[model samples]
Target: MATGAESGRRLRVGLLGTGGVASKYAALYGEYPRSLLVALHDPFDPGAGELAARFGGRVAASVEDLIASDIDAVVISTPNPLHLAQASAALKAGRHVLLQKPMTVTLAQAEELERVAEDSGKVLALYMNSLDNPVFRDLRRMITEGVLGKVGSINCKLANGMGHVWRNRPANFWRGSRAAVGGGSFAMLACHYLNLAQWLLDQPIIRTTAIGTNLMCDHIEGDDLMSAIVEFAGGELGVIEAAWCVKGEQMSLHGSAGSFAYIDNSVVTMKADSPFIGEAIRYETPGTRVVLDGLLAPAMSDWTNPYNQHRCFVDAMLDGTPVPMPAGKGVQDMRVLDAAYRSSAGAVHVAVHVAIHVADDGAVAEAVA
Candidate 1:
């Protein structure tokens, strides 16, 4: 362990925003031995004192101060557009960063962040803990073990009812702001699944089609129901559907040789010729207990488990384990999202182009660092 003057057993960390997602990271930090919450920063929170009291962290008056602190990393859970600026600050500060998904509101910002991450030689990660999830791990293993041959098609579906939290509610709801929060519920809520489809399949989206609307929530300018169809380079296709208005959750996966799904986290339905889909098989593969409890549990619950992601960050930073989500993939998701947005507005399919860049020093970077 490094000394207290140098970090000891705990990696000092900071938070840029204390929203729903940030709270998940904070909760996770509480459980990880490799990290400690040293500072908290949220410009709009009136309950900073209470938050600081619970977390035993200093309340930063600004993001700049948080960056300047003695933290080795930061969990940036700020809103959409703010991600670009906040993440850039953390990276430039020479701290590793774990950013909320969708990297940034635009491809350009995501690309820029990727560059900075390489330049700084810091681990810039996306909170895409799902990639390290039990279901995906199991899925990947099954696919690798030849349980699902060829993966001809995968339909990735997600749905959740956002509830009527925006009706004259607390002052903290920024779901309706596009500039601050970026796209509506889809970008914030469902973009992860879009990313999951690509990552879990080990492919990028080649083409995409999207349709969404602002029908239900008048509180913000974002859409309530988000849907998309993407084709992968492997000649495989996937469909992603998410609705902020959906009351129950469901995910179904279909491959050439099998099919599986879980509904409301209660029932599991699967059919595979490879015999790995039976009652004897557990979704939590033997080696992934921490990931199962930390990332999968919280994601399965509406509340995502406390510190799996942060701990994952620590494992990567200290032990050099391969992290599930890299900063570059975050940028790729944003590119697909950008194509989806353009597809919706034009009522036509758009080609998805995720620009993968290599820095002058030969370090590879994604558009969103």
Candidate 2:
């Protein structure tokens, strides 16, 4: 691990896979004072040694070797399919894990990972990194506090534009492949919206119907664009639109009595409506964003892109506290996505079982959506 002078204490990290996702974890985790990317397992590019040189750690020859290393945690940043395998290995090896999103494309795989984590009693966290944004944190808090009313409906739209799906590639480039990604835009991008949806409404998706297709990305096999309507346990409806359409990027949300708009890809909201209409709520960036915007964040700007989720997982494992966003929830979200796809294909409504609803009056109403 990376030791700093006499402190001699750093949270050891064994990172598996060296892809865009893993790189993000590497960069974000490096910012922590107590964290070090000590060991790595990337047969394609063993930057662990070089990373160790940069951050003060060692490069392991394989995931198994890394597991054997005295690391505090593991960041499974491998491809979509490898998540379960790698995470299962790390959990059995007695390491906390920060698994990348889509958790797994299939419910079965997700359940297996969940079962392992539960059996081992280790921390298994999912990096739905965007939720780490301070804005999202505040957003959820407001909804929980009833700052937003009944939340009768929610509309979410994300535009990929011409940018690469993973970096200079098309949206859902890898995710478009079912064998690889499990679902189309619904699984990859809409999952974020769905996650936020459940959080915002504090309810589960009661029923859903969706339609998707690979419209723009001619080469992609899955849906580049997907439109879905989800009814939560409270009969609250949510509309989602995702695609690699727009040339740049965009995202926004409309709620029962308020709305949120983001511009220029910043997590900071350019505009947010109050539960009472035109009333405005200033943007409060999410926790992950606050740490990510670098030193400039204290100046009152939005901070984003840090792997605070992983940091939280690290803390949870070390401290034995149960924080939200566990790997099991990631698995649940995949099941929801699977439900939506099934609904879309069958041209019928699929029901969801987990639901939590906080009324506009601050009362908690829970049910199976």
How would you encode candidate 1's per-residue C-alpha lDDT over 1-369 as one tens digit per residue?
544335546778887887555665565565455567788888776665566677668888788999999888888877777888888878888999888787888888889989999998888998875644455556666767766566777665565666355666655566667665567777876677878777667889889888988767666566778788888877887777766666666566676666666555445566666655432245433212111112223442222333356666666776655666898788888888888878877885555777899889999977732
Provide the lowest-lDDT 10-residue window in model 2.
Answer: 294-303
lDDT of 2 by residue, 233-296 (tens): 8787778777754543334555454455544345434322333222123434322112112211
Error of 2 at 69 (Å): 1.3
Q: Estimate every model's Cα lDDT from 0 to 1.
A: 0.70, 0.66
- Model 1 residue runs over 4 Å out of place are 1-8, 169-173, 277-307, 348-369
- Model 2 lDDT at residue 85: 84
Number of clashes in every candidate structure?
13, 16
CA shift of 127, model 2, Å: 1.0
